[model samples]
Target chain A: MNDEKTYALKSKRIKWFENPLISEDKVYWKPKRAIWFWLAVLSFAAAFGVNVFIAPLQETQILPYRIFLASAVFLLLSLHAAALRNPFLRAKLYHYCQFIFALGIFLSVWDLLTDKTSVLPVPYFPSAASVLQVMVLDHALILKSALYSLRLFFAGFLTGIVLGVSSGILIGWARQWDYWLSPIIKVSGIIPPVVWIPLALSILPGSFSTGVFLIFAASWFPVASMTANGISSTPKKYFEAAQTFGAQKKYLLFKVAVPHAMPNIFMGILTAAAFSFTTLIVSEMIGAKAGLGFYINWAKAWGAYSKMYAAIVIIALEFSVILLIIGIFRRRVLRWQKGIVK
Target chain B: MTEVLIDIKNVNRIYRDDAGHKIYALRNVNLQILRGEIISFIGPSGCGKTTLLRLLAGLDKPQSGSLSIEGKIIDKPHFERGFIFQQPALFPWNTVEENISAPLKARKIYAENKHKAARYISMMGLAGFEKSYPHELSGGMAQRAAIARALLSEPKVLLLDEPLGALDAFKRSELQNNLIEIWQKTKTTMALVTHDVDEAVYLSSRIAVMTSRPGKISKIINVELGQNRDRNDDGFIALRKEILKELRLASISPQPEYNI
Candidate 1:
């Protein structure tokens, strides 16, 4: 036989483990079994150890902290086991762990109600009950503040996007524009929006406008910079190709430059959203009488720690939702870019 | 059939580096390409085959002398010329149909001749993938789409700069055959720059052999094969041998003076 034919025959005859052609599913638990099993064992051991250590610390003799610790351990173990050959077994294990954590929370809550004495029940631990009390008791105030903050955030972010992308395109395409605009933008970008709070206070008519201005300032630079970078790096091949196609100036910008620079534009939007949120909060704290940031600050001054924490939590939740929506938008727009890893 | 389409007269390109050293990309290059002729440029790497093709396409200007297309002095790229590069260069956001329609749409001919614009989609063998994006395609398929986009412009002349150089061997040959068939049917004036000697000889009516480093046209050999030339024929082998000998000789020659 020829050398290539012999080599092929030898390869085919080799064990499945030795064969690079063999699928990952075929090997199953043979390779990752030991690691999975050890992870399961160590995680469960850690959970049980934590439970034993934390059983005596609480005055009411509740083991809630221990239960949560154990819950984490079992969750980790279940995930590890799920990654193994049998997913059914992994699901069953995770379900059982969830049940154990629920039981732990239940037992601890019961202990607190029966063993402790206070007018406002379960006042200390800042559990789900306290979070619920803060929201339900001050429902009208909290709702109003949240709405106001959201409005400010959206206003600033939208304004930032429009200003940033337009200016970025201008700067990106024209060298003279870039040279002229870059330093002014740089100097302004470094001056914090919070520092602008006093300036906004002096000139702005309303506190809400001040907050919006702060958000716009914070968000604008990143969007502009990212968009500029995107346009500048617009592939020379596409530019030349479009030109050869007799694409006029407008068509070239809209068809070639815009789409090629979209990922960076999306990145700019994301960065802008993040900056807007952070800046909005700072502006509200320093200048505005309304918004989640002001609400938290107000609650803290009155030593309403639970209300302060609740307001903080609401802000976090709002940010998460906005980020999720943006993520969905990004995925939909850039669907073609899926399966490509940097 | 022998009507001249592009006349490149004594073209010279000289660039000065940041350190003030002169780099000559092309020098005293004169060539006339006939309408509906499939011409190939073949040379070692860094030869000015691509630069010459670009000049012909009106994408670049020669420092001295002039290029005329259809007896008009070419200052800028016109609707009559189209360029395809090794990269597919398809817009990621646009579908295959949209990419193909871009040239037509850009020229404001899309509204009146929508069906005509869409015809190139099938012509390029991307019929079913009209709505498909560039990133969704394999490398070969994307390059095919690029070819479709270029052909959609209905340019009199198509300039291809190693368009099939990125594909694997099988795909490369497949595209090569398809491109030749397309050229034969469409009869568009073409100037293809490629490093592969066999490819240049296979596709072109005339192969312009070029020298390496500050490239000069060494020779322009006329290929005498029939329209449907057999690759394994005695003539093909003999021509390949002659061209190979010329290339071998071209490689060993000392640097020619860059006369502006």
Candidate 2:
């Protein structure tokens, strides 16, 4: 097993530059000389080269040349950092470089289309510089909207999680509860939360509560259903064993069943998070005054395409950061399942 | 004779098979387990050894009879009867120490008896592995942890259902010795269900050979070879062969069938 692990590790080593003349055992694959690293560096360089030498077709054009240059340099310095000696960091860097290469190519293409040739429709496909400029100019507005969205999103998301998981456990544990609540959940959970918008708007006093309700409804079903499934699927032997040890009902529910169902609960949370985000945007678009969704809609209505695109970029980053945080929480809680799972 | 710690009177456990036929897991099972004595139930796969063990643990109820421990009718599980499952059913989320302390904590006595966790950990030879989770431990180590957990509650009778069945021969023998040592130290009445005839001969004062399909105790043999018993001794080997023959005969006996 040790030999096999070494063989697998060796096979994965980055072999970019090596002396073929050297003995087989002596030749080690080093990340510093990796072909992907060099290719990524060259792509950044090419993007800068194109931006600096070729002037924009439009006189008013402002390219984000400095940002691109800075990013490239940071990537180069990070690739050489001592931290890359750690296998996990090295693997991340390898993947990050590939992403950077793709991004560089995408930016170069966009720059060519928008600033140089003007082949694509103007204003709709804004230059990256214009989007960045709008981001800087409207920083306060964007920040306020982001904070607003976050407030509404989290308020709904947390409530959904708490109620969903608790009720799920109860329903799964008790057969009588399952008989009554299962049908309600099955019927109501199927209808998309957005469909309740009309009813929610009329019933709730304000748009904020309605928006929170929509997000809550959207997030609740996945968590509740998955958590129930997880709890119900826990092996019967565990319950029996716990019973034999004189464990009471409370201990059986929380200590035994809940811990066993953690992996599945986390999976439910992931799905719920995705749903909440989608619902958050839609809810804000319909009735909210100050949020990312509202800002994007407001920008589009006013024909400020660059600002709209900038808001969209912010939303994407926000969503990914939320997901990353959840992933970290899962790793911590389900630490025992680490090697067994992934 | 020692006092009867457990009395099983006309105990009959019924179950429904996959084909929707009512089968007798245990039929007219009457036995008295003496206090501070080790008893082994040996039989084939479908025999009611495990069913009997479960009844002793009060995890299951008999259909038409009663099981009593020390004059009290046993209907539900209690801390006084520690049960060790075939699989170390250690809670995967908890460490070895936590698993051992679970029953104590459940009974709301852990605060006073917390040190017993450490004592049992070392007793099971899992000194350094107190914080290790179930998955981290090897199969034998996990089973030992399970045994320690069961023992921590300090039950009067320890019921084992093929506890060492999953272990390799080397680990099984080592654990068998550990079991004996624990039994001597604690003097807890033990009722172990297993299929290994040699294990029965080595561990028990009496071996109850059971038959399947309307499972019944066909024979009960008294092992007169005293405490300092040797597996290699002619006496031990002879008893082991005798029990093995009884188990073989029990297996080949005509099985009663229930018509659907």
Candidate 3:
């Protein structure tokens, strides 16, 4: 049937019949490189063209926007050139083209509407350039604030994870510990970490430390509860199996129970992270001297909406970066759960 | 072979149903496990072969009487009795080598016995799979690693609770051969709880057949087929048939207490 004569003789040809190209061995032709690079460059070029030709309704920093668009176009071109070396990256760029094109069109519309005409209000709906200006011009201050926030986050998160895991292990294993501590964990976990601001301010000595405590409180409960839940739900057979191995309580907790609860503990951490980040921002806005939260508040008071938007963008960037790192770590730690994990 | 390693005398385990009726998981069970001999407990489901195995493993307590090893009362589980569960039950986070070496590390004797893990790894035919996780392995290979892990600890008595119940027939028979070879090499006394009559006859030296509902041993058949028994042989088939007939009788016996 593979030969053309046999294929012709057959009343109903197979799906691949009448095709000139035949693969002796099963293999596929290489997929063509995606055209995202050209689209991205063209899109950015269009946005840049709109920025240059259009006149603003009021005097605003248009230079930064122009430079940003130009650089974006240049970067896209360079990336396209670089992608020639990496086949995987070429595929990813193809996937990104539509989004990039859409974003470029959106930016052009925004620039024309905000800068060219006061369609959405002059001060309230700042153009993309003004927001980018804050990120580019005030980068040093923004970076400093980010550093302070990250320091607080790490301090709180590490403490919370350490204390949470330990307490969870204790509660899950010991009936007495579960009896005493579970109620407190349940009660305190329900209350928002922001509610502790007043109490933390009064006792914690400084706003920065209070911020840390607030973040810690935010993270600790979910982690602890999840760990406890994970350990508690571990199959009784695991304990019995380990017991037959003369496994001590420590070994049982770590080797048997802890490993079993790991997925749950990870779930808890993800929940805790969402809560912790929100807690950090709120606490910083309330009391901290140098942080993105404080910067956001300061920008709001001065009616610098663009800078406020810039701070939020920075916050989002930080969050995305942290999430990316965590995702990588989780993938590695839970690599054993390759096929089945939801 | 004559020396007794574990003795179970008049052991009883009872559970209360929701309606407050007493369900006898095991009742007045008596058996002696001999040193360096592979003894199997074969019965129908709910016949407490596993319950009896667990008693020997010290994973459960008998309501009455005692379980002892070398004249020492077994009130709690110890490494002296390595228990292989129905499932391989290997730690998912660990690699094959890591799971095998877990026992040595748990005892804080890793420095001295770390080499034993590598030896058992190859002995169990798990040479290239040292770095592979349990989830990555097939059913037979994972069980092989589980067996290797248990054997690494060098227990006086190994308790197996239907360790081959999950595999396909081909894999099951393959592991059966592996088990016989391992037993011969280690000379570690083993107590297997199984429902498969062929498995019981092929692997064990003595078969303790039991009945359900107030589970107790109904008959004990000595399988002296010697080492390297051929499954197609007349003697092997005879013993298998005899055990099957005994099981048929055991299952059909009505509960005397249930009778009005």
Each model's number of backbone clashes?
Answer: 0, 0, 0
Docking level of model 2: medium
Task: Give model 3's TM-score for chain A to 2 decimal places.
Answer: 0.86
Better of 1 and 3 by DockQ: 3
Ranking by DockQ: 2, 3, 1
Give candidate 3 regions above 4 Å deviation: A1-36
Better of 1 and 3 by TM-score: 3
Off by over 4 Å in 1: A1-127, B17-19, B256-260
RMSD of each: 7.9, 4.1, 5.7
State every prediction's TM-score relative to the real structure. Answer: 0.81, 0.91, 0.91
Model 2, range A209-232, lDDT digits (tens) per residue?
A: 998899888878889888999899
Residue B136 shift from truth in candidate 1, angstroms? 2.7
iRMS for all predictions? 1.4, 1.1, 1.2
Q: What proportion of the real contacts between chains A and B does each prediction keep?
A: 0.80, 0.68, 0.62
Cα error, candidate 2, residue B99 (Å) = 1.4
TM-score of chain A of each: 0.68, 0.86, 0.86
The local lDDT score (0 to 100) that residue B183 gets in candidate 2 is 87
- RMSD of model 2 against the true structure: 4.1
Q: What is the C-alpha lDDT profile of model 1 across A47-151, one tens digit per residue?
A: 445335434322332244445455656666667566444443433343344444455455444434433323233333344334545776787999899999999
